[model samples]
Target chain A: MNFPSKLIEDAVNEISRLPGIGKKTALRLALHLLKQKESVSESLSQAILKMRTEVKYCAVCHNISDAEICGICASNKRDRSIICVVEEIPDVLAIENTAQYNGLYHVLGGVISPMHGVGPDELKIASLMKRIEEADAGVKEVILALPATMEGDTTSFYVTRLLSARGVKVSTIARGIPIGGELEYTDEVTLGRSILTRVNYSAE
Target chain B: MNFPSKLIEDAVNEISRLPGIGKKTALRLALHLLKQKESVSESLSQAILKMRTEVKYCAVCHNISDAEICGICASNKRDRSIICVVEEIPDVLAIENTAQYNGLYHVLGGVISPMHGVGPDELKIASLMKRIEEADAGVKEVILALPATMEGDTTSFYVTRLLSARGVKVSTIARGIPIGGELEYTDEVTLGRSILTRVNYSAE
Candidate 1:
């Protein structure tokens, strides 16, 4: 589309570079910004630039943080013995929102995907092994909370194999029909897994 | 959702304020930006801020431009005797893309919408009238090329009533079934309009 101004064209081009945003949507967003107060645009630009320039990653867990070590890893309240392994910072946030897990996290940054040229060495897997080997840390069990995709499975398998030799218990999150899912609508693979992994019910 | 860092939280909050973007989508976009090169984020921020600060509007038609007079309004190739009135700058681009209409434009900025607290005074209606009255411009006709919505119709009606007293020819774009639209699937109002406004077939 022909833009009346080079500035608008530049803004639209930059905005359309974002994932899921097309040229039309970018134009709409640029016009909306034009109609809004100057402070709105200023704040948005400042926030984005500041976040990009000053963002930090936790040295221990590899999760995004403002300090050397993340809050979860540094906190005494969280259980250091059980570490939940995740693919990214957002996964850590998703698990934290449940408020069910009190253990620290080990963010692998991403799962093993050969298609994307991401290998085991590219992730934080080596650091995870080092953390587990530290006898003073007292890490006993590692929960594989990564996605259920093939890449996730490959990463989990590789991590578990390495941990088995080090005498650390490695477990994966249960895969089955969701809590509120209907059995008839559940896929065959998940339904079959749910039955095979069934456990005895107890009132206690 | 809980973010690991204050910077990420602030960026997410600001980004989510944009139209059609929710908290979850904003989080995803923010994380995507974090993973990209720093120059990408810097350029996006710089473009948006610069556009907002330095963007200019055309002096004659109020369309967005980099200079006082827009290219369309200042061009000698465009028809000066005919003006197509539109709701916004996008409409101008849409018509221009067709490569059919060569007339100049008068951008109303927006339609008359009392629901949104926008009225005739808020738009560029008065300036349009002044342009029509200017003897040197030689404007002989005005086309109402607004949307088919109620607000668009209301604004067109108001403008037509004001222009009728000045003895200038007034016309509106035809409302009918769109090209490639099926007769069975077309809406009743549009189909009826199409039939009512049908022209005599002449083998040219």
Candidate 2:
């Protein structure tokens, strides 16, 4: 496919590598970027470069943050006694969008998947346990808001066992979500129900 | 909605400005960009920044080109006398993808749209007429592959009148495409038929 320029082609290739974007859509996106005002593209480039440079995981919650601790972790009004365990920073955002859960969050960064070679150690599980044990507020409940995937279940099981031995109440979201659909695609109502009807997990 | 970082927010906003993208999709795209290798993002950034510098409109054909003339206009073997006029560079790429049309092309840049305040002066109509009048190859047929929209029809009518006055045979693509549908989305077979069965428009 003879592109107008090598630069256009390179941008398209990079964009196509993204989730859900194809080559044609990537080309369209690249063209759209090119047609935009110089400042718009410049800001976008600068943003990506800056994100790569300055963004880091919160030492407390493991969520992407610009500071040592995320805004959620720093907030004194939030329920310090409760911690919501989620897969990624986006999941934390999803929960926060509801303005429903006032509890703090512990972003696992990823789920435990033997197939993908991601184990419990690969995630921020140890930090979560340490947060529960040594927490100044003495955490009472740990809510599992991970996706209802096989890997998600595995990670949840591992966390529940670790937390139960330490005598912390560990629970998971209800089975209201569809079997295979991702948590990101689920509507707020269903997600809210899944969170509201959460059940305790018996450590094995 | 309270993004973790200003940089991430900027990237999301920039991606959301594209044709069909929304805020949610933009965030996903931005996150995807963040996950990519540094070199990939750098290449994408440089490509976007270098668009105007690397690509220029062909001086003769108005098609996007790296050199003074596009590949079609520069090619010695192509039928220089038969100029197929289209609305944009994407149309040129669509036609070339078929490997059927061996004729040179003239890109109008856009069609006449009085509602949107676009007119002949805004398009490359004058240059097209100049190309025909300054015919080094003794040009014969001028194919109008402009869209089948109202504005496209008006542009085709305007071009046909100007060409017919100079004793040139002007033709338009057949009416198989649905109204308001773009030529870019049309199937190759349907587009090919439209090209093959083009009708002569003798200005009354």
Candidate 3:
């Protein structure tokens, strides 16, 4: 579509470059921004630039942070003996939202994917191993909370194999039918695996 | 959700302030930006800031432009005698995409909505009247191509009533089932209107 103004076109083009946003959605968003107060756009621009330029990775976990060490890694409330390994910072947020696990996290940044030319060496795996190998770090168990994709499985296998040799207990999040999922709609592979891994249930 | 960094949190907050975007999507977009090259975020920031600060509106039609008058209004090829009135710039784009219309456009910026405290005075309706009153404008027809909602109808009624006194023909775009729309799935009102406004068919 021919834009009436070059400014609108430029904004739309930049916005559509984002993942999942199309040209039409970008146009809608650009118009929405135009309709808002000037301060909204100003703050949005400032926030994004500031985040991108000044953001740092945690020295220990490699998660995005403001300082060398992340809040979770610095906190005394979290268990230092258990480390939850994740693919990205969003995973850390998702797990933190549950309020179930009170452990430190090691963000791998991405999983090992040969198709994308991302190998174990390209990730923060070396840092994770260094953290685990520290004599005084007190880490005993590592939890792999990566996705259920093939790349996630490959990364998990590689990490667990290395950790097991060092006498560290390694585990992964359970995979099966979701808690509220109906059996009829569940995929065959997940349904079959869920049944095979079923635990003894005792009704109260 | 709790963010690992303050910068990420601020960016997410500002992004989520946009219409239709929630906290989760904002977080995802923020992380996506974080993973991209710094130039991507920088250009996006600069584009939004420049557009919001330097964008200009056409003096005659009130459409967004980089000059005093928009290209459509200034062009000699367009039909200056006919004006297609719309609610926003996007509507102008939608009509332009069809490449069927050859007339100029008048963007009202917004529709009349009493609940939202938007009145006729709040829009660019006065400038539209000013354009029609100009001796050299030679406007013979005014098409109300606003949405089919109650607010659109009210605005159209208000504009047509004023324009009728000035001896200008007032019309609206045809309302019926869309092209390629399945008859069985069409809504009752639209289907009924389609039947009522059905034209005579001739077979060659």
Candidate 4:
């Protein structure tokens, strides 16, 4: 599609490079930006540039941060004896949003997907092992909170095998029907897994 | 949702401010940007900023342009006798894409909508009249190609009334069922209009 201005064409092209955004949507977004206050565009541009160039990953957990170590790793309130491993930064955010986990996080950056050319060496597996095996780290438990996919399971199994050799305790989050999920609509594998891992009922 | 870092949160907030984008989508975009090369974010940010700050409106037609006069208006090949009036800049691009019209265009910027606090004065209506009334301009015919909405109709009627007083020929694009549209699924209003405006079929 032709744009009335070169600047608009350039903007639309760059915007459409992003995932899920097409040329039409990019054009619409560019037009909307044109109609808004200059400060709006200024802030948006500045924020994106600053985030891309300056954002740091925590030295210990590999989570996004502004300093050497992330807030979760730095906070004394968090359980340093436990580290929940995940695939990406968004996973850390999702688990944090639940407010149910008080342990630290170790972002693997990505799972071991041979199809995608991502191997164990491409992730933070070595850094994770280093943190857990530290003589003074006192890491008692390592939780695998990854995706419910073949790649996630493969990564988990690999990590579990390595951790078990080092005499470190490893656990996984339960896979079952989600909270408020109807049993009728639940997949058979998940339903069967839920039944196999059933816990004693407690009214209190 | 909570962000791992202030920078990520700021970037997400700015991105979410765009139309049709929510916090979750914004987060996804921010994360995607983080994973991409720094050059990608730099180009996206720079393009948006440049487009917003530097884009110009044509002096005569009011379409988005890089110079005071748009390329269409500056060109000698385009017919100056007729003008196709549209509601916004994108409409000009849409018509240009069709390659059916070779005449110049007058972008109204928007239609009259009292509910949105947009009056005739808010658009380029006055500039359009100025261009048409110019003695040496030699503009003879004006085509109303606004939207099919009430505000579009109101603007069209108002422009036609004004142009008629000056003895200028005014016409409107036909409204009917679209090309390749199935008759069975056509809406009642459009099907009725298509039948009413049916023209004699010409083999030549």
Q: Name the best candidate (by TM-score).
A: 1
Clash-forming residue pairs, model 2: none
Cα lDDT tens digits for candidate 3, B45-149: 999999999898898888899889998988999988999999988999999999999999999989999999999999999889998888395888999999999
Fnat per candidate: 0.90, 0.52, 0.92, 0.91
Q: How many backbone clashes does candidate 4 have?
A: 0
| Candidate 2 ranges with C-alpha deviation above 4 Å | A177-204, B177-204
What are the candidates' individual DockQ scores?
0.90, 0.50, 0.87, 0.90
| CAPRI-style class, candidate 3 | high
Where's the lowest-lDDT run of ten residues in candidate 4 chain A? Answer: A131-140
Per-model TM-score versus the true fold: 0.97, 0.84, 0.93, 0.96
lDDT tens digits, residues A6-110, model 3?
999999999999988999999999999888889999999999999999999999998888998989988998899999999988899999999999989999989
Q: Tens-digit lDDT track for model 2 on B38-125?
A: 7767766676667634667789998777678777788899998899999987788788887878898989989999889999999999
Candidate 1, residue B184: lDDT: 99
lDDT of 2 by residue, A66-142 (tens): 78887778888898999999998789878888788999999898999989889888999998988888898699999
Candidate 4 clash pair list:
none
Tens-place lDDT digits, model 1, residues B23-99: 99989999999999999999999999999999989999888988899989889998999999999988988888888
lDDT of 4 by residue, B1-204 (tens): 888899999999999999999999999999899999999999999999999999998999999999999999989999999999999888999999998999999999999999999998999989999998883768889999999999999999999999999898999999987889899999999899889888878953
TM-score of chain A of each: 0.96, 0.82, 0.94, 0.95
TM-score of 1: 0.97
Worst 10 residues of 2 chain A by lDDT: A2-11
lDDT of each: 0.93, 0.82, 0.92, 0.93
Model 1 docking category = high
Weakest ten-residue segment in model 4 chain B by summed lDDT? B131-140
